[model samples]
Target: MLDLYDRRIVASLNSKYIDSKLAIDTLALALKKHSPKPGLLLHSDQGSQFASQEFTAYCKENAIVQSMSRAGCPYDNAAMERFYNTFKNEYICRYYFKTDEELNLGTQDYVFVWYNYTRPHSYNGGIPPSRVRFR
Candidate 1:
């Protein structure tokens, strides 16, 4: 997964399995590259990935404030939710992954090359994210 901030991919990772501590570590490593910039308001759902003790500890260590929505409220993380929905609908659902590497490479291409450089986002003045970032 790649974390998007100001439409730039700050980090990238390949996850065979998703674990809370791994997620925290990946995020922390990424944030370390941009340290002293206030802090991240890490928002997530009540999933185990965000609720784990290790994850919370990492957040505290990094001065990241954790924010979660009320139970059953998806809108709280609506941007991510919408992105996932569009990703699955437009890419994953239509493709067959013969290998994990293939899937990872395809995802990298989609996020970095296609989504950021080609696809236009309405929220970003109807231009691709890459252009907006340069602006």
Candidate 2:
């Protein structure tokens, strides 16, 4: 999950399939890391993983208000689209991981170290997301 306020990646996971389980697990990780108050708004694409009954129930149980992009409108979730573009070009394309474990660790490091703490973001006036978030 990405925090729109600061552009921080609150949680993420990699899986072979985009299923409700993956959605729920990633959301659970975000919840554990940051205890947002009730009525938190979660914006996402209208994918089956995000629209499934289990995922909906999980959001409701966590007091999250879910919002989805309009059908076939990627612009509605432009931030996420941009994030994925950057993630792919800046990180994914630079390395080859031979194992899932390596990929997971590499992803964690990228989000926690490089992306959040070091990389400059145009949205935050060329500062890192962590700086903008924690300043």
Candidate 3:
């Protein structure tokens, strides 16, 4: 869900359970929203979902290039590492959720409105990710 260029999160999902189907669905939804071009690069860790045949076929059909992080190497996906750290430190740890619904809503608000639109990134010259796109 990380945008390599602007460091934006294109989409996210939360649920009681997750699998390849959920990953594929989120990817489809994200691409629909963004209208990705051919040769678009989608980088992710070597999770089972990302490695699944269904997800691989979808990416291939859509002309998206897939790059996976190396095993045991966090630096290969440093952007996601930084993002997860920020997310945990700033929002996830600060919230006290009593229900799944509440947690989902809070995550949605934090990712979409606060993280993408309001929070500034040092990599983006202190501008929000939504305002710092290269294209």
Best candidate per TM-score, number?
Answer: 2
- The Cα local distance difference test for each model comes to 0.73, 0.92, 0.90
Tens-digit lDDT track for model 2 on 16-128? Answer: 88999999999999999999999999999999999999999999999999999999997889988898899999999999999999999999899888988999999899988
List clashing residue pairs in candidate 1: none
Which of the two candidates, 2 or 3, achieves a greater lDDT against the reference? 2
| Cα displacement (Å) at residue 88, model 2 | 0.7
Against the correct fold, how does model 2 do in TM-score? Answer: 0.96
Candidate 3: deviation at residue 132, Å?
A: 1.2
RMSD of 1: 2.8
TM-score on alpha carbons, each prediction: 0.81, 0.96, 0.92
Per-residue C-alpha lDDT of model 1 across residues 1-135, encoded as one tens digit per residue: 334444445545568778886677668767876563557677777988888999898889878888887899877777677777777898889999999999989988977787768887776778876686543
Error of 2 at 32 (Å): 0.4
Q: List where candidate 3 sits over 4 angstroms from the true fold.
A: 133-135
Ranking by TM-score: 2, 3, 1
